[model samples]
Target: MSEPVKVREGAAGASDDKPGFDLGSGPGRLLVWLYGVFTVAAASRSVVQVILDFGRAPLAYVLSAVAAVVYAFITYSLVRGGETARKAALVCCAAELAGVLVVGTWTLVEPSAFPDATVWSDYGMGYLFIPVILPVTAMVWLRRSARR
Candidate 1:
């Protein structure tokens, strides 16, 4: 008779040394997809505006570019799928939330301040508030993943 193969389980039933849940799986997958889409959307919009008429709304254009960078970094971190990446993504998500709040309030308080809208203008009202909501969701996911 052939011998039966036995599988070894590590601590907490994990078979490997990885310390956290996969950041790119389950709901994280949706977050990654959303971030990726935002990155592309914000990047393209900023690039076109900066190239065509940056003087028209320099602050708005710059902020859009900043949003794009933040989105890209979060997406990368989520896809990386490790403890370090989870921490980094958490920090970035916090920053992103702060930026959205600050810019959203600024735009509301002083409409003239931004002749055009950035990705985060009005808490991402233009983009259906996804900009504001995404960071919070990502932060929660990252934190939860850390405990796994």
Candidate 2:
């Protein structure tokens, strides 16, 4: 007769050295996906705008590209899932929130300056405000993960 196999605690392919933070689980998963989507969308849009209409609205287009880069980095950090990555993401999210507020206000106050919309123009009205909301949510999630 053969004995039944038994699995040990923390031995089901799990590691005791596992990170305490997981920024890609549950709601964090959604945040990562949204950031990824924004990365692609902003990057592609900025590329085309810079290529064809750089003279028309250089500032707005450059901001779009910058937003894309930020989103990409945040997504990567969330997926990396560690204390260091979480801290990096937290800082980036704060910066992203500040950018959205500044750019949104700038667009509202100086409509003539923009002449075209960036991802964060008017508090991300063009993207249904996802650009504005994403960072705030990410910041909260990152903070929560750090506590875990």
Candidate 3:
């Protein structure tokens, strides 16, 4: 007689649901790393700008702070890696894209409006356009990961 296989109760593989959706796998790992880097860069830039001279360009400084916040949230949500977090990341990414386009255009149309450069200025020219590209990439990753 042969012994039968035994499945562990409450184990992730034993259940229909996946072992929790992790956004830090495969390609997503790169996304996560990039997001992390951006979070630090944006936050540090904004803090220094806001503290050093709030009057030079209030609008640009505030916008940079907002970008930092958005980046931090998206990075957190991605690392958290759950359905709710994924949805939050999706929403934030879309907002980030919109911010980039608006800021980029505004900087071009009215150079006087921004006395200083933001993360999204000139479509993220200061950061090699990574600010504009990161959100789009994150959105795609989030969508594909949801399906898998």
Candidate 4:
């Protein structure tokens, strides 16, 4: 098998000849953790929406379901690395950012548009702002790993 790349600070900082693999490599693994969280949140929200009141916020519920699927896809891409997957993940992240922004604005401007709540409703206020932070982090990481 081929050797793995050595990770250091600043992408060109001092290099250490430490052999073997470093668990710290590959997007710090916490990304996967966060993605897992999003998966659970989106999936659960969609399920509850469908069960409790699917007819109330059909569009919002559909968007939540879409978000859940996108989150799942991103998790898979991150876990299984490849150029295509990475690119697709980036696109998904970008789309997620757009979704949050648009939905947030709509909720603020037209509260009636969403009779109930979706993942992006109120900018994910119920989720303690993680929804706002996640997409930004994804974009940053994508920029950092753009070479890939």
> Candidate 4's C-alpha lDDT?
0.77
Which of candidates 1 and 4 is the stronger one according to TM-score?
1
lDDT of 1 at 56: 99
Better of 2 and 4 by lDDT: 2
Residue 54 alpha-carbon offset, candidate 3, angstroms: 1.1
Per-residue C-alpha lDDT of model 3 across residues 52-114, encoded as one tens digit per residue = 999899899889889989988988888778777888899999999999999999999999999
Clashing pairs in model 4, backbone N/Cα/C closer than 3 A: none
Candidate 1: residue 19 Cα off by (Å): 4.7
Task: Give per-candidate clash totals.
Answer: 0, 0, 0, 0
Q: Write the per-residue lDDT of candidate 1 for residues 1-148, one digit (tens) a residue.
A: 9999887645466634364567989999999999999999999999999999999999999999999999999999999877777888999999999999999999999999999999999999999999999999999988888777
Model 4 regions lying over 4 Å from their true place? 1-27
Q: Candidate 3 — worst ten consecutive residues by lDDT sum?
A: 12-21
Order the candidates by TM-score, highest first — what do you get? 1, 2, 3, 4
| Overall lDDT per candidate, in order of appearance | 0.92, 0.91, 0.87, 0.77
Please write out the lDDT profile of model 2 over residues 83-123, one tens digit for every residue: 77888899999999999999999999999999999999999
Report the alpha-carbon TM-score of model 2 versus the true structure: 0.88
Better of 1 and 4 by lDDT: 1
User: lDDT by residue for model 4 over 23-132, one digit each (tens)?
Assistant: 22466377778888889889998988888988888988888888899888888877765555666778988988898889988999999998877888889887876777
- Between candidates 1 and 3, the one scoring higher on lDDT is 1
